[model samples]
Each structure stands twice: as structure tokens, then as C-alpha cells.
Target: MPQNIYLEDYTLVQPHSNFVIAGGRVFIKKWTSLSFNCTIVTGNHKPTVGLNQRIIERLHINDIEKDVVIGEDCWVGANVTILSGTMLGRGSVVGACSLLNKSSPPYAVLVGTPAKIVGVKFSLEQILKHESNLYPEHERMSRDELEVLFEKYYKGLKSMGTDYLSPEEKMKSMQYANMQYKI
Candidate 1:
């Protein structure tokens, strides 16, 4: 059983049974909030040639294990089930009763059974300002200071290393991408 769990500061997790099990890691970064009845499972029974669903009968097959990473400033709502190999990036918000089975980019607002990215919590510019304010006590910065801040903070969670697209731009991109799916 692997016991390499990393929970950072200012994390709030509500009471629940079997919240996190052993045999893998669960890294919940700083400023995260997990609501009640949330389960983070890190191991799953591997499918075998035999049609036995019982673990005892499938003992010859090894279980698949992977880490679950919930990044900083995240909000996981009630009854969320995060499976193995899932990565919820920084500043994400998972809505209630969501089943997160895939990785998400930073600041993604996810909902539904498979947990699709609906939107982001804040704009990149605002997030940059928020991060700058966090560095030294929440205070406004001068123009030059802001420039320096951007230079340093651009590499961090605030910037996804891409241009912040407008809604129309996003729609266009999605439309272009969806063309591949058409028969």
C-alpha cells in the first residue's frame, strides 16, 4: 500500500467514509475545498480473460493504480467521484455529483458525469492580478511592478501559456475542431 498523500495548507474536507484509500497518492494542493461524500479511488480491478467480477476470483490479475492530483485553489462539490489517473489542475471547480475520469486544464469549471470543462472561474488577467496580490498582502501594484510581476508569474498557474481567447474565438476553435468528428 502506497502512503504518499500530500495535502497542502488551508484545505477543507468534509466528513465522509472511505474518503481516500491507500495503495496510491492523492495530492490536494493549497486552498482547496472538498465537500461531503466525495470519494477518490486510486486503484481499480483489471479486466481479465475470465468473466469473473469478484476480486477473489480475479486475484491473478493485478489492479491498475494511478495518482489523483487536485491542484491549488480548487472547489470539489458534494458526491464527486474522482477515479484513478485523474488530474484536476489549479483553480478548478467540480460541480456536485460529477464523475471526473479525465484530466482537466487549469481553472476549468467541470460538471456532469464525465466532467467536461464548462468554463473558467476568472479571466486570465484577473487571475494574474489575484496572484500578484497574494505575493505580499493584497495591495495594488504599479505599472512597472505589474510588468515585473507578469514576467515572473506568467510561468505559474495563472497563465496557461496561451492567448486568452474571447467567446467568439473559442466557439470558432471548437467548431473547427468538431469538423474532424463529422462523417
Candidate 2:
């Protein structure tokens, strides 16, 4: 309902969804789903040294805002808490009762507190198929990158930001949605 909140066609938020959209934007792309009792926070509380809690609260001066993004076709499970500045990459599967605090790679299957990467939602071939329908040919991940991502996942390594989307795409998505995500 706010100007800073952008939901593209086919975005879904189920019952009991709570969003704290403060100084920044919250962008959800097409086909993303948020399950029940999900909480998305787009801002933080400022710690002021001298200000009283009631005064700060009454003045609304204790807010620090940041963007939040849920990428296309992501599945966020029930009772999840997505914190400020987190980006759920395209087709990510977030496990129920998880706490997500950081950005994740595309197609990742995330679970547990702070949402560690446990698996990938699809194989490389399947990912290719999935992205083909959701993204343009130029935007899809190359076979080499897919292989690299799989290797990193297997080795418990981190994914390079460019493995899923480009910087230009990230900027565009941010500009379009006034929200989050990056390459």
C-alpha cells in the first residue's frame, strides 16, 4: 500500500504476514511467496546515547532504514523472519521457522537460524529451465557459472555475487522496486 513497497505481478503473501517497512523499500518480484506468520523488517532501531526511550519513540527518531528484496519465484516458508537488507535470490527456498539475516544465492535451499544454505532447490539443468521461463536469455546463468555455484555449494564455499544476476540487473531491480537485492 505504500509507495516504497513494490510487488510485481503474481507476488503472494499469505495470512499473518507482518512487514516493518521503515525508511527504505521492500520489493517483491513476480511469483514470490511468503508463507504464514512471516515477518519482514526493512529498518533497524537506532541507539541514541542520550535520548529517552519514550521521547525517541514518541518522536519517531530511532529508525534506521534499509532495503529488503525477495526475488522472483522465491518460496519463503512459515514463521520466517527476514531482517533488514536481505535479498532472497531467484527461486530460493527458505525453510519454515528460519531466521534469515543475509543475502543468499539463487536457487539456494536455506534453513535454520540465520538461514544457512543447506542445499539448492534445483539442479543446474532444472535451474536453467526455471530461469528460462522467468528471465530473458541474456539474464540466465551460464553453464559455467552454474557449475561453479554447485562446486562452491558442495565445498561449503560462498557464492560469488555475479553467479545469479548482474550488477546492472540488481540496480534495475532496485530502482524499479525501490527495494533490495544485488549481484
Candidate 3:
């Protein structure tokens, strides 16, 4: 029942779900939502061992200082587990039932058990610029202002692109493609 969960620039719905988040800054950029049943645990994983002694001394679990930053315009699927020291970049999508053990780069889509980068959301320059704008210290702008900026840079890309299917749709398409696998 820990409250005061630090959520910045991130949207979280289905609040009744149980989860623990500690000692890490959670930056939820614009349009990013953390769905129900998601657990973000931020604590030290380093186990301390005493030298020259067979017994283990006090385990020094450092104050897991790294912030869990979820970039802007991203969707975090349900039942997602984000471990300590994880950084998810902007415009990224994390599929459900995924375990994030490592920091993810900007504009990268991650999925599966070990959470591999399945897709790239944007170029390095774009990501860097977006990060600079999204930094907390910078002057905060309205959502409309951000949208206008995005449109200016990404309108052409959006128009030229086809509609991106949801994870469920993609799964169904895959199943359909493999006719050998019966429903």
C-alpha cells in the first residue's frame, strides 16, 4: 500500500492493481500510459561479499539510484515487469508479459521474455532532440505545443506510413500466415 509513487509525464490507469515502485524517478513522457498489474521495482541488486571470510557480511544493496524513464508517446502493455535500473526511450512500445532486465535505448520497441528490441521508433538525432526537449529541467510546454512540434517534424513520415497494427492483430496475422497451426 505504498503511496506517493513518483509518476512524471506518464499516465497510469487501473489504479487498484498492486505494485511496488521505490527509489527511482519514473518519467512518463507525454501520451505514455502504464497499464494495470504492472510492477516497477527499483532497488539494489548488487550482493556484497566479505573478502578473507567465508561468512557473508552486510549485503550492500546500493540505493538503486538510476531513474526509470519511460519516454513520451509510448504504450506500456499490461502485466509488464520493469526491473531496477531500466530506461525506456521515447515513442517505444513494450508488449505485455515482458521482463525488462536491461536499460532500453530511445525509440526502441521491446517484447518477449527477455525483452529484445523488436523495432526502432526513431533515429538517433530525433531521439536526442526529443530527450533534450523532454528533460524535466527544460521549460515545460503544453501538450498542444508538443504535438505541433512533432507534426512539424514527423507529419510526412506519418502520412507515408501505413497504420501500425496492435500486438493482438500482429499475433493473429502471424497465426493466419502459418496455416499449419490450427486454431
Candidate 4:
């Protein structure tokens, strides 16, 4: 398929430079929010090419073009820069001013230049508990998967309570009714 920007419902990607500088392809899935001053670049200039040809060569080269894919329920903080070929997993949380050049796992908390996985957004128990009733049975994160992530990025049983889920009704099956869907 041809490369193009594909935005699903409830995804907010702030305007980038007012114009497409590189015309790179981007796909932002649902429930994702990108903050201000963020840049997602899909085009990379070939270093071997001569100065004059570098700019033109990047657009022509088949391998130089790569698309950026942001998964669902991701929150990308302000001043972040995501380079080409980056795929942020679902529920990824990138901190402000981070420079992400590669992909990330689900619920990863990324921060700093050349963003690193600082930690996961929530503890394993909390995440599992939170996702149980919200997402469907099949769509929910499997225990095996969560366990592995727990070993890797898990800290402790943090924020496992539902007190923050005020109004209570919001923790139901995800539908189109409650979302703003746009910035």
C-alpha cells in the first residue's frame, strides 16, 4: 500500500511545521494524544550523497522512506521527536523533550534524549486489573505477556485501586460516545 498519514478516531497529532516538510507517512491509532512541539520525521537524508543530491536523493531512494506508527492509548509528551521507522506500542507514555528513534513496548514510560524505557506506566497487577473490565476478554493483555513485562519493567503493586477512576462509568467498554476524538 502507498504511504500516507492514517489517523484513527480519538487520535490527536498536533500540527507539524504548518506544512509537510518530508511528506513522511504516519499512522496514529485511537486514544493517542501527542503534545505540542513534537516532530515525526519519515525522511532521512543519505549521508553518502553529495550535498546538493542529499536532499533530492532522500526522496528518491526507496529504502530511505520509513513510516511512523503510534499505537492506541499512547500519550506523547511535549517537544518529543520521533524519527522514521518508529512504532510505539499501545499505551506508551513518552516524556517531554524525548528523542525517540526506535520502537517501544506497550505502556512503556519513555524519557530523555534518545528516549529510553524508564519504566512501565503502571504495575502489572494494576494494569491487569484496569484492563480486565475495560477491554474485551480477547483484547486484554494476557497474563504471560504481563508477567514478562512485570519482570522487565514492573516495579510494585502501585496504583492498583480504582479511586482515580471517578464517576465510575468511564471504566466500561470503550465506545465512540465519550471521546473528544480531536484536539
Candidate 5:
């Protein structure tokens, strides 16, 4: 993997999954959950004209490479496939057996074969109202507090640069991973 890639701790990428981060840059924000049989592809082989030539034999076979970014507080269900050039916004939820090949809005809930936005987990007003609970009200991080934490984390992910992972992104990622949520 390149130095630009960042994988926050406590990210539950289950077994039998492939995160092809070596081919290109991939920035997975904190507290993201990827279930079993998920595949994140950042590169794809281009079409060749010759019929007889094998993939290995063809020299200079063009390859399209693009960055795959997963925002914070996102949950990718089992058998999900995230293709190259896909940018998932923060606090997004992807249903199981979905194929995500395009960008999504923040707090969107996507499901289906091509992964269309079905609904939002939380309305914009609801999210903003719970923002204050992000800080530790009493150290336990009640349910309301957790929601605030997720929103804060999402903001950090939203601001990640094309270069290195920002401090806010890292802090949000690692912080939520240590919370009460199980992988």
C-alpha cells in the first residue's frame, strides 16, 4: 500500500475480503465497518485488441487507476463491492449484497444491485441537533452522545485531503472505533 493510504484501527474488515489498496490510494475513515466477502477495487485492466495475447503477455496494457475513499461512520454490509473511483460520503450505510460504483451524498443509505440512495439514516436537522453530544457528557457516551460522535467523525472524513490523512480524520476514526460498537 502507498504511504497515502490510511486504515484506522478497529475497522472490522472481515475474513475472505479483499481491500486492494496496493494498486492505488484508498482512504478509509474511522469506525467504518466492512462485512464479509466485501471487495474494494481501485484499479481495473483496460481492454486489449489482440485476441491471442494473454494479460501477462501483453506489454503496456493500459490500466485505469483511481482512488477509493470511504468516509467515516460508514457501514458496508456483507457481500458489498466498492469499485474504483467511488467516493462514499460520511455516515453512509450500504445494505448487504450491494454494488457501489458511484459517489454518494453524506448520510445516504444505499441498497440494491447498483447501490442507489434509498433514504437517509438521519435527517439533516436531527443530525445537527445532536452535534453537541459528541463530546463526552459523562464518559459513558450515551446513545445521543454516540450519534454526535459519529457526526463529528464524519466531518473529519469529509475534510480529508488527496495527500495524507488529516489529524481530524485520524482522531475521529480511532476515537469511534474504541467506542461501544462491536465489529
Candidate 6:
């Protein structure tokens, strides 16, 4: 972890998820989840060209500021390297072992080196609506409560022939349903 690294309203689970970010920015939006072994580095690679020329000046620049912005309700898989200025949009999924070098569009599933959009997670409207409710904190629910909540929401989704829910909406709904059952 580095100074001024912002992980706003997100959840990071797993032991010892270390990062080396020098003068870099990391923004994890609301309800997003970052799994184990995720690293973001701001240092540029060693310059291979001549040191005197202005064209090679960028090569010697060691302290390049790289910012990583992960949007709302995103699921970042384990061992992911989010490079400088990489923006993953709302409701997107980054697959495991991927290197994100560019900005991803909202709701897109991205994977691979120089990650490409593999699929869409959900419609923008659905993401916005659903994420308004669910969040990672719902994992705090007791086993029995979680079971009941899952059964209720997942069953409803199955009936509707849908397979996904935004992280925040899903968690909040579960927590709400659990509370209802308790009373």
C-alpha cells in the first residue's frame, strides 16, 4: 500500500495483498471487490536508449505517476496487475492473470495481456439499478441468513432467467432479506 491510494467503498479480502505504488493513485469505486495478490506499480521500466538525447529523457523518468481506477461493482480476479492509468468501468469483470493497460468500458468482461473486452457483464441500466443496493459488507451475514437470502434472490433470478447481480445490490438485498426473516 502507498500514500494517497484511494480504495473508496470497496472490499479487499485475502491475506497480505501488498502493493508498491510510488506517487500513484488507486481508486476502487463503490461496491467493487479486489481479490488476493493484486499489485499496482507506478515505476517505469528501465530505459534502453541513450541517456543524453531528449527522446530518451522519458526512458530515464523513473517516478512516472500511474493511476488505477476500478469502477463500481467490479470483480477483479486474483493476481491481476493494473498498470498506470488503467480504468476499469462499472460492473466490469477482470479475469485472473490479466494485465490491464488501457481503460475498459462499463459492464465489459476483460481478460489477457493488454486486456481486451471479452464480454458484457450486464446492461448499464441494470448495473446502475442493481449496484445501488448490493455491497461486499453482506458477506458478514450468518450462514443461515445468507442461505435464506441466496435462496430468495437467486430463485427469483432463476425464475426470470437471469444469472447475475451487481455486487452491492446483491449483498444489500441479501442483508435486507436476512433482516426480514429474523423479524
Clash number by candidate, in order: 0, 1, 2, 0, 1, 4
**Could you give me the TM-score of model 5 versus the true structure?**
0.66
Task: For residue 46, give model 6's deviation from the true position in Å.
Answer: 6.0
Alpha-carbon TM-score of each model against the true structure: 0.67, 0.78, 0.54, 0.76, 0.66, 0.63
Better of 1 and 3 by lDDT: 1
**Angstrom error at residue 129, model 6:** 4.2
Which candidate model has the greater TM-score, 1 or 5?
1
* TM-score, prediction 2: 0.78
Judging by lDDT, tell me the better candidate of 1 and 4.
Answer: 4
Better by TM-score, candidate 3 or 1: 1
Clashing residue pairs found in predicted model 6 = 133-169, 134-168, 134-169, 135-168
For residues 75-137, write the lDDT of model 5, one tens digit per residue: 999999999999998668999999999998667778898998776666444545333333233
The number of the candidate with the highest lDDT is: 2
Q: How do the candidates rank by TM-score, highest first?
A: 2, 4, 1, 5, 6, 3
RMSD (Å) of each candidate, 1 decimal: 14.0, 9.6, 12.1, 4.8, 11.1, 10.8
**How far is 35's C-alpha from truth in model 3 (Å)?**
1.9
| Alpha carbon deviation, residue 136, candidate 2 (Å) | 2.8
lDDT (C-alpha) at residue 180 in model 6: 25
Give the better candidate number (3 or 6) by lDDT.
6
- Please provide, for model 6 over 119-169, each residue's C-alpha lDDT reduced to its tens digit, 9 standing for 90 to 100: 656433444334444534452324454345334323333111144669988
lDDT of candidate model 6 versus the reference: 0.63
> What lDDT score goes with residue 95 in model 6?
89
Leading candidate by TM-score: 2
> Worst lDDT window (10 residues) for model 6?
152-161
lDDT of 4 by residue, 68-93 (tens): 89998899988898898899988788
State residue 19's C-alpha deviation in candidate 5, in Å. Answer: 2.1
